[model samples]
Structure formats: C-alpha cells, structure tokens
Target: MNQSNETTMNPPLNQESVSLEPSANLVRTIAVRERPANPGAWSNTVAFGWRALLKIKYVPEQMFDVLVTPIMFTVMFTYLFGGALAGSTADYLQFLLPGILAQTVVFTSLYTGVTLNTDISKGVYDRFKSMPIWAPSPLVGAMLGDVLRYTGASIIVVLIGLVLGYRPEQGLVGVLLALVLLNVFGFGLGWVFTVLGLILRTPGAVMTISWLVLMPMTFVSNIYVDPATMPDFLQTLVAFNPVTHLVSALRGLMSGGVTLGQLGLSLLTPVILTAVFGPLAMRLYRRKR
Candidate 1:
C-alpha cells in the first residue's frame, strides 16, 4: 500500500488586520523641500573673506611677521641711526614713524601673494574654482581680509612710535587718515603680488620675487632719510619712486603739511598699479591650470 502525505500551508495575514504605528521610523510618503536661492556675489565674497579670517585665527603664527617686523624696525632704526641722522632718538622717531608705517604695510602686503600661491599649490583654488560662487570672490575676499592685517601692522608701528616719544602733529585725525591712505595703497599694490601668485610655481618663489621688488622700493625711497640730502642723481631717482611720494604724503598728513599735489602723487602709482594688474590678475586666474 502507498501512503500520500498532505502539506498544510497557513493563510496569508489579512491586510486589514496589519498595523504599523505612525511613530515608526519608516516613511510611507516622500516630501520635497524647496531649494534655497543661490547666494549673491557679495555674500559669496564675504563668506570667503570669513574663511581667510579663519585661517589667521587658526594659525596665529601667520601674524608673527606683522607683529615682530614693525617693532624691530621701529626700535632698531630709532636707536641705531637716531643721533647721527636726526640729533636725537626722539627727533628721529618723529621723522621716522610715518615712513615706518608705510614701509610696514608695503612689506606686509607680500604675504597676500604668498598665501595665494600656497593655496594654489595645495589645490585649494581647484576646489574654489569648482564652487558655484562668483569667480573673483576668493581673490577679492583674501585681499579684503588682508586689509585687517595691514591695519594691525600699522597700529603696532604707530603705538611703538608713540611709546618711543614720536608724536603726530596732526593728532588722531591725521593718524587715522594716514592709515586709510596706507590701506588703500596696500590694496592696490597687492594685485601685483596676486598676479605673481598666479604665475609663480611656489609660494617661496613668490616671496623671493616680492622681496626683490620691495627692497629697492623701500630702501631707495625717503623712508629712512631725506631725499634732499642724497646726491642729485639719487634724489631724482627717489623723487620718481612711488614709495617716496607715499612716505612724503604720510609724513605730511601726520605732521600737518600735506598738499593736494602730494596726495595726488601718492595715489597715482597705486591707481596705475591696480588698473594694470587687476585685469592681468583676473586673466591669469581664469586661465590658470
């Protein structure tokens, strides 16, 4: 006799009897939120500016030069050559402070390009290029952030000078105006370094080239000595040096003798430098690999 076994199967659960709490971590429907509008160029620029500020915050050592160099120059020159140059330390400081302020800002401006070149070398600019923000915002914002650095350096130089018995004849207003002018010229001069940053392969190279350009500009100008005391040929060369005019303007502003011609001359080179290098920098930035 053959025996057959029957297999029993349970009925499927009824859909009506099934229950799931609304609190369950399961979504039965999809919801879409509206996308926010894109940020404007100014917003983008400010954001990048904040980023630059953050770098300074995190790497406070970045300010070492800004703080130390001005102090060194102010103290060293004030004492070393003070008696020979101007008869007394106090007297020399009065003559030197304004020029030191200008020199400090010009020197500090090189860091802008050094920073840009470092970022580019490390591929930060590549990411920036991929972002949806305005193209020049990074460059503009970095320089804007640097304006604060310039201001800080200036304040340090001024304070040191004040401590050393240097007094501004025009008082607070003159000092403030001089600072404003210094920053404006620094902003314009920064584009030259920005262009260097784009073209140079390394931050070191940018720094080297910047120093090469800066040494002659700062030393040959009326920063340390009166151009009138130099030989006639040297005096003529100093007269044409943009830094010479800037130093003169700054001195005049602080000491209460600035003229319209001096102010105009001080601004002329910066205006021309910005006009020429600003476009050149943009072009190089856009085409940079």
Candidate 2:
C-alpha cells in the first residue's frame, strides 16, 4: 500500500483519546536518562562520610593516634618542664594537665592534613570522582572523623591526669566541659588542616607546613604558661591568642573561677574558626576535586 494512503486509513479514530499518566511503561519510554540530574547531593555526602568511616575501620591506627600521641605529649611535657615550671611533679601534673590537653588537641589536628594527603596520593579519592557523592563530603567527613580524635585524646589525657591525682576543683561538670571545648576547637582546626592537605602536593609537605603553622598558635597561647609570666609583647599575643582563651576558659572552669573575658573568647574562637575554615575548605575541596 502507498504510505500516504496507509496513514489516511489509520486516522479515522479521532473520537478516542489516550491519557498520559505516569506508569512503568510510560516512565521507561519518557524518562530514559541514564543518571539522575541532581544526583541527591546530600545523600551522596552521607555516603561519602560512610565510606571514609569504612576505610578507617580497616586501619584502626587512624584512630589510635588520637589516644596515644596526645597522651605521650602530655606525659613528656609534664615531666620534662614540670620541674622548672612547678615545684614538684604532682603539683606540675595538676597545674599542667589542662594546658597539655589543649596543646595535644592542637597538635592532634595536624594529622588531619597528613592522612588527607595520604588518601589523595593513594588514589582513594579517585573513586569519589566517578561516584555521585557531593564533593565537599571527603573534606568535611575527614574533619568530622578527627572530632573523635579530639574527644578521645582529651579524655585520655584527662584520665591519665586524674589517675595521677590532678583533680579539678570544679569537679565533674568542669571535666566534661573541658572535653567538649577541646573537641570543638580541635574540630575547627581539622577543617583548616584538611583544606591545606587537599591542596598540598604531598603528605610530608603537609606535615612540615602543619608544624610551621601550628607551633606559634599553640605556644603563643596560654597553654603551658600564664600570659603575665611572658614578655609584654608575647603576653599581649597570648592574651589574644584563641588557644589561650580556650585553655583559660577550661582552666577557669576547672579551677572554679570563670571570667567573662575568658568565657567570651573561649566561645568565640571555635565559632570563628569553623565559620572561616568551613567555607574555605568547601571551596578548595571543590576546586581540587
């Protein structure tokens, strides 16, 4: 039959109409795109986070560093500088534990960059490129993972101090508050390091940079000494140093004399850090990815 005549013969059913409701067959015909357009970005973040956790599961040492490194630092500093700083070992441990815990948390944040660099070099993140995961997840997830490190590190140091008879006059609540501040402060620092690691070329380079960046921030703070004891310029620096505020806040709480200035600075530093670093990390992370 001629094609024109065949079409004309089939056109007679104008009175009947077909409806278009969504159905399996309709979807198959109309919605054949291979991947979702938006790709459920939040869910992808959760997935990426879960993946990092799973990787950490296979290597427990990723977590153990938090417990061990901080403890070692606390012990070393207490014994090494205790004699000069305080009259006796017992007195030093009590006076020094909180500062060491703060220092430990700051030092502990360095590994965020190192491990993040390790993952990038090992092609661990290459898999992420091919997946639907949100790009910010790895950077953020790594930071979150290290919050555990901060908490664990603080707890270990505090427990060791406790066993050594480093009692806080503020008792249980102070101790708990100290741990909370440590983790929050350290978590913000992790974001800073995590951003640096993602952009840095190598783990060793990241480590070197971490030391350069962290030392001044840690030492200039009131971590191990009172600001009044330092030189005038340094005392001013220590007075304004965020870590010092954190240490002071924790110390004040432990010693049962919370000052408005310490409390204000203590609350502000971590919030400022995370607010500043959070966006920077996300931006750098997206660029690198």
Candidate 3:
C-alpha cells in the first residue's frame, strides 16, 4: 500500500469523537461533554419552577408580605369605611371580604410582569436559553410558581376576613371553590403579565404601565362598590371590566347565591382576558431575540 493509503487507514481521532473514546482522559472528557447539562423534565420549565420555589423557600420572608397584606387591607377597609359603606362593622366585613379577596389577587398578579422584567433585565433568561432545555420550561415554571402565590394570597386573605368577622355563607367548600376560581384566574393572568414584562424594558416601567391598566380594571368594576352607585359613564365601563365578573363569581360562590349567569361571566372573563393577552405576551417574548 502507498503512504496515502496507509494514512487514510489509520486516521487520527478528532476532538469530538475522542470524547467517546474508552481511555481514561478521553472517557472523562466524554463523560463531561456527553452528560446533558440541563437534563430531563425539570431542565426546562419544571426546573425553573423548582428554582423559583427553592428561592422562595430559602427566603421565607417573601411570603410574609403575602400573609400580612391581606390582613392590613381588610382591617383598613373594615375599620375606616365600615359605617360609610355598609352601615356596621359586621355587615362591612362580609361585603368588604369579597372585595378584598378579588382586589388583592388582581393586584398581586402584577408581580408576574414585574418579576419577569427583572429576570429578563438580569440576563437570567439568556442563561436558560444557553442550557439544554425546552423552550417552554420558563413559561411552565413561572406559571406553576404563580399557582402557589395565588394560593397563599387567597388563603391568607380569607383567614384575615374570618378574623374580622367576614364569614362566607359558603363555608369551607365555598372558600375552597372561591380559591379554585381565583387560582385559575391568577394562573391565566400571570401569562399576560409575563408577556408584558418581556415587552417592557424595565421592571419599574412594567409596574407603572401595568398598574395603570390594572387599577382601572379593578376600580372601574364592581368589587368595592356596586355599579348602580356609579355615574352612568363609569357604570357603562364597568360592564366591560373582567374584574367585575371575577368578583361577582367569587362573591356568588362565597355567598351560595351566585347565579349561573354570574358564574358564567366570572369564568368567562379571566379566560377571555387570558386569550387576548396570551398571544401578545408570547409574541413579545419571542420578539425579544
């Protein structure tokens, strides 16, 4: 055989193929390389979710605000405006309870966008992209995190309401059902906020723009006061506010007096809001890079 033929027969192993070689160093390199950095299911969204949970777990104090805020809001409204709104503390507590539950949840949902903006600005998402993971992991993880958040906020709000003499006629099952609806509502709302965060360049900007959007959605609705008490223009706008439908749904479930029509509106509103915002949010997220 000629020299050229001999060289072809005994070709040298390249760096990539050497990684799979059986020699100790080669094998070690292979193991280091062949092992997927972001492995399995949690590698993507589930991983992100677990990471967020762990972060919160390590920082237990983050939840303190969630627990305390509900109490503060209920107390503020009950003691300050009890007589003005409902004529007595007992009556005010009951009516304000539903309003507090709905408003607290709606406001808390803003964290989704605000937190998302921080993650983006901090280059954390870029790290996720570099890892060996699915595209949907962060989205899945963030959404799951929101579930826990909503649960904590809702439960605390309910408990505070109880301490203040705000008993739901629906009792335990009613409270649970209200929580379920709120959880579902919050879950969908997070997607909208996450997308919003992706579009907004700064966390403060996200909060500012979103608050402007959210405040109107909450106050313009029938949460704290009945729409009939409002001006005609405000009443007309309230008809279109999804928060009104959500509060109505929660109130009906809590009071054991919610009609099918109200329930339908309640469930329908969050879902529709999700649909409208979901696509835009995802579009904004992808458009980033």
Candidate 4:
C-alpha cells in the first residue's frame, strides 16, 4: 500500500519534470532564433546602401529631379536672368554656373528628408527594425546613396554650363574640387532634413517645410546677383548667409580666385552644420520606436 501511494506521487513529479524540460527547450529555441547576427557597421551600411541603389534602379523616375531639373534651371536662368543680371548670356554663364551648381545640390538634399519620411510612414522603417542590421544603417546608407544624386546634379549643371559657353577657368581639377566641396555641404545639410523626416507626419509636409526654409536663404544669398548690388539690409543678410560663403568659395575655386577667408568659411560651414544636426538626427532616430 505504501509503495502504491509513493508510486502515485512520484508519477506526478516525473510528469512535471517532463513538461518543464520541453518548456525550457522551447525557450532556448526561441532565443536562438530571435538573436540576430551582428554584422559590423561598415558592412551593414554598404548593404543598406546597395538597397537604396536598387530602389533607384527599379524606379528611374526618381532621377528626374537630379537630371531634368538641373537642365531646365540651367537653361531658364541662363537666358532669363543672364541678360538683365550680367549683360549677356555668355558673360553670365561664367558667373552663374558655379552658383547654379551650389543651389542645385543644396536644393536636392531636401528630398532626402521627404523620402525618409515616406519610408517611415509606409512602415518600411519598421521592417528594417526587424532585421539584424545596425540601427543607423538605413539612414546612413540612404544619405550615402544620395551622394550620387548630388554628383549627378553637379555634373549636369557643369555640362549644361559648358554648352552655354560657361568656362571654368580653374579647369578640370578645380571643377572637381568644387564639386567635392558641394557634395560635402549637401551631405551635412541632409542630416538636418533627416531629423525633420523622423519627426514630421508626412512627406509632403516635410517638403513644404524644407522649401519654406530654403527659398528665403537661396533668394537672399549671392547665388544670383552680387550682394553689393542689393540694399543695405539685404546686403547685411547676405553677408551672414552660409550659402553666400558657399557660392563665393565655388566661384573662387572654379574661376581661379578663391580667397583664404572664403575657403575657410566654406569648410567650416559643413563642419558646424554636421556637428549640430548629425547628433540630433541620430538621437531622434534612436527614439523613433
């Protein structure tokens, strides 16, 4: 009788142990499956960047802004404002080409935010979060891929300018350097837009906000006309404008007369913008979820 009672009690304990074993194994299996592989930052960034490039391949229309817009603006502004602003199209082309390149690259950077916001709204970012890649891979990769657009715009503007008889007296090397500087500035400025994308509700709203901020700066700067020609108040505004310094630096590098002061300011502007906006963007990105 005692043996029977002990056996009955012991059976329950054995069954409990059996049940616990499977539960523990199941938890281990789940943990192993859930743990993602840690690819280093550089490799992850490149992989994600390739994804962005593939997106452009599938949707070639995205190139329109970099391709068509630069051509149209180069032509329109050269003819429309050339004669009035600088006496003739040929003379104006020389002065206007570099400025146009600056404006085109800077303006193009705005789209980075718009596209980012679109991705977030579409739940693409959430999908990314599920992957094992570095948290910042998406954002950094997108921005890196955008360097191509900036380069394309710079090339298109320069090619159009060449066709319009706008010569870069600084030659190929100088033109290349100027392009490098513009891309740097564009990349740094893009971080600010990235932060906006993180916080904004819609892509359209991001674009509108970017335009409102950019238009006034572009119009008031020395991109089109000499700041000296403007009234005192406008000139004062131009004097402090970072765009003005960028244009001046480009003109100097491309036209063979960039001053030390202009070069220093041009280099410093991107550094300052990146320092301030880059961390802000990353912080916002981390808090997104």
State each model's C-alpha RMSD to the native.
8.5, 10.2, 8.8, 9.4
lDDT of 4 by residue, 1-289 (tens): 9988887879988788888998999889888856566779898888877887998999899889778988998899999999999999899888888888988998999989998887766567777888777787888889988888999989989988888788899899999999999989898888889988999988889999999989987889998898889999999999998889999999999999889999899888889988998888888887786
The stretch of ten residues in a row with the least summed lDDT in candidate 1 is 1-10
Off by over 4 Å in 3: 1-29, 32-44, 58-61, 130-133
| Candidate-wise lDDT, in order | 0.90, 0.78, 0.79, 0.88
Q: Look at candidate 4 and give me any clashing residue pairs.
A: none
Off by over 4 Å in 4: 1-38, 122-124, 130-132
Clashes of each: 0, 0, 2, 0
Candidate scoring better on TM-score of 1 and 4: 1
Q: Using TM-score as the measure, which candidate wins? A: 1
lDDT of 1 at 110: 97
Give per-residue CA lDDT, model 1, range 58-110, as digits (tens).
99999999999999999999999999999998999999999999999999999
Candidate 2 lDDT over 1-289, as tens digits, reads 6977866776655223223334656878877767657656666656656766787789887777667877787778778888888878788887788888888888889988898888866565677666666777767666676776777778888888887778999999988888887787887778788878888998999999999978998888777766778789998887767888888888888878888887778878778878998898777765664
Worst 10 contiguous positions by lDDT, candidate 4: 30-39
Question: TM-score of model 2 relative to the true fold?
Answer: 0.78
Check candidate 3 and list the clashing pairs.
44-137, 45-137
